[model samples]
Target: MGQKTALGSLLKRIGNSNQGKVVPGWGATPVMAFVGAMLIIFLLIMLNIYNQSVLLQGFSVDWNGV
Candidate 1:
């Protein structure tokens, strides 16, 4: 109980401290956008790889029963 109150107050104080502050270089929105773009690119690349693997598997042949 006491610990929770202390943590809550600490978080509130920290939040209040940053309310009117200015951060330099690449704020949250641009950073988040960049991260989102990178994630999308990564997902596309992975999807392409998976599709190619599946297509290649379709072309594989077994010659053990002659």
Candidate 2:
């Protein structure tokens, strides 16, 4: 079909154009460090909240109320 031929030619042109391109962006190291720092902060906050909850609730369970 004509549509199929047009689509194939469009794809071929795009492939040829992008054959040796770098597509630049940030390298991995700094982005990874940022993500790692955020994860540590999140874990610390969660641990603090869990400790507070344990202190207030004293490990008691009321399963039947569920």
Best by TM-score: 1
Compute the lDDT of residue 54 as modeled in candidate 2: 37
The whole-model lDDT of each prediction reads: 0.74, 0.74
Q: What clash count does candidate 2 reach?
A: 0
The pairs that clash in candidate 2 are none
- Model 2, stretches more than 4 Å misplaced? 1-26, 53-66
Model 1 residue 31 lDDT score: 85
Candidate 1, after superposition: displacement of residue 47 in Å? 0.1
Residue 6 lDDT in candidate 2: 81
**Each prediction's RMSD to truth:** 7.4, 5.9
Q: Write the residue-wise lDDT of candidate 1 on 1-66 in tens digits.
A: 345588888999888987878989776988899999999999987777656643554443335533
Which 10 consecutive residues of model 1 have the lowest summed lDDT?
57-66
